[model samples]
Target: MKTIVFKALPFDKTLLTLALESGVDAVLTSADKVEAVRALGRVRVLTPEELPSLALDSKTDEEEAVRRLKAGEQLALAKGWEIIPVENILAQVPDVALEVESLDRARLAAGILERGADVLVVLPEAAKELKAIVREVKLSQGTIPLVPAVVTEIRHAGLGHRVCVDTISMLKRGQGMLVGDSSAFTFLVHAETESNPYVAARPFRVNAGAVHAYCSLPGDKTCYLEELSAGRDVLVVDASGETSIATVGRLKVEVRPMLLITAKAGERTGHVFLQNAETIRLTKPGGEPVSVVTLREGDEVLVRTDEAGRHFGMRIREDIKEG
Candidate 1:
């Protein structure tokens, strides 16, 4: 995850509050103000004196920055630092924090080397842009390529435990969770972002899947629905495969009628057991969601393909298979 550090220098209470509300990872302020910042919220507070400073004005300065980074000290690059030196330092060390004075610079710093810097120090002058920066750099989880798969089978699975993931974030129409029996071929299960006559919209929830199923998570990790709990992070993907992190506010596991959905994308085939209800939906190739109850054989839906191997929820290379 990318870190967003707010430069709360000169003790601006509003800026500190903004940082706290924006979910910034840390606040850089004077030593005396650290406690006050903590009083506002739980975040890392860094004093200028505690961080090794670097001004990449010359070859010697760049070397010092690289040396300090190698020595395990998190060096904060001074503003006006050139991209080449930052890139050079990033190539050698992954913990270097770049001080960005504007949203543009923050975007540039994040896109460096295509992996971005480990941390960004948003200067006080850019406080107004802090929210935007945090949203773009911190909330965005990039994208995944989604493909159309043909539904090969649908069976009425016996009543079993189903997990309804209630997230703290309100989801949009195209947003949902990816879940399946195997992590290698999870289906895009749409969220309850649509309102019907029988039930009002519960935009914060996704009637995900069976307790034993794999739900796609951030950093390419997967966790079983039974393993999810309040405060855990889950990756929410849209029809276009754009992803963002959502905090799990609650998990509802109940005995509900389930349907076994099997789909095939190319030669790969996989299945997921989901609640058999009209509100439970799988996303179609064009982004519209089709209810699980209405899902039929030959219907095309979006599914993600991957290597079908997981050990303790983490992807691993081994001779492993799952039905």
Candidate 2:
């Protein structure tokens, strides 16, 4: 994940306050204004003396930047830097920082060479779109490649312990967690963001599935639903595969009738045991939540499939199989 640092030098009070309120990772301010920023809010403050900004104009400057980085200098590439030069530096250096004045440049910096810069130094002039930039870079873990998997079967699985994940952040209709019997083929279990005559919308909850199901987490990891607890972070994904991090407020486990859902993506087949209730839903292709009771065989729904090998939730290279 890229940490965003807002440049607040030649300090403007409004910009500094906005950065703090917008959840900036750190504030880059002057030595004199360090205390001022600290007084305003609690944030990691960086001074020019500690973290210097460099402009890459010529070959010598690039070399100097690399040399300084090798010598353990905290640095950032100033704005107006070309892509080739950044790629050259990035090829040699890992986790370099870059200054971006807008959301577009920030996106470019974050996607440079696929594994882009680690830190985005947000310029002060970008105050208006600061929240959007931060959300897209920090929260939206880019986009995950989603595919439509045809439902092959759905059957009653009798009574079982189910888990309802209540996150601190409210979710939208198409957003939920990805979980399944295997990490390789996870279903887009729709959040409780839709309402019915019998139940109010639970925008903060996802009636996830069976307690033993595999739930996706950040950093490409998966964990059983039973392992989740309050304050832990989970990956909240949308039907379109855009992801955001949500903190678990609490876990609600109860005895509920379960339904086993089986679907196939390519040659890979996967399953998820969700609660057999009309309120429990899965996402459709067009970003709508369709109830499991209404979901029939041959109905297409969105799912995510990856190479399936996990050891203690971390991905590994091994021939592992799950139903």
Candidate 3:
């Protein structure tokens, strides 16, 4: 999770609003203007006096900055700090905020040491370029390859605990979450984003799966459905495997009649436990949502296959097996 901080110095109302609309994590403004920014939106507003600053003017200054960072202080580097010094400081500190005057510098600072700076302070004049920086640094988590899988079997699994993930953002018809019984193979469980004769459209919900299933989240991690909560971020993926970030607005867990669905993609097999209801659906390869009740053997659906191993919800390399 790369953090974007907008430098709204001198209290420009338009730039403050742009920061909020761009989804920046915080705004760097004056102490007196904090309330004004908050009145417009909900975000972290910090004044220059509230945070410590370090000027990397020389070797001794750089050493002092490293010491301050080692002492556990969140320090922001003054603008015009050279890349070499910035790289050296980043190599020693994990949470240094770099000040950039333009979009090119932001990109360079983000790519420094390959891990990049912990935070970027974009000048207020660069508000127009903030959108691209945020999208690139935050939403670009790479792509997942989705393949067509044939449904091998579907059977009633009796009553089980299911999870309904209500997100802060409205999803589209071809969007949903990736979940599975195992980390190696996961299915694209479609969101209830379409209306039916009996139920109105719930474009903000994806009745994810059973409590024990693995759901793909941001930062290349997986978590059980039971671990989700309000304010937490999750990855919402589309049929083409393009992904964006969504915050959890609420989570609903209850016992419901479930169906055990199994499918085979290439030589690998995978399954997911979904609530047995007419609204529960899995996405087909063509981006169509098919109800689980109507899903039959030989039906083709989309799935993602990967090396099957996870340790503490993060993918790891090991000789392990999962059924």
Best by lDDT: 2
Q: For residues 101-212, could you state the per-residue lDDT of candidate 3 as single tens digits? A: 7778888888888888888888876788888878877666657789999999999999999999999888998889999999899999999987889999898999999999
Off by over 4 Å in 3: 31-42, 49-89, 101-108, 112-114, 316-319
By lDDT rank, best first, the candidates go: 2, 1, 3
lDDT of 3: 0.88
Which lDDT value does model 1 have at 100? 95
Measured with C-alpha atoms, the lDDT of residue 26 in candidate 2 is 95
Candidate 2 lDDT over residue span 116-197, tens digit each: 8999999987888899998888887767888999999999999999999999998988999998988889999999998899
- 1 or 3, which is superior by lDDT? 1
TM-score of 3: 0.82
TM values, all candidates: 0.96, 0.95, 0.82
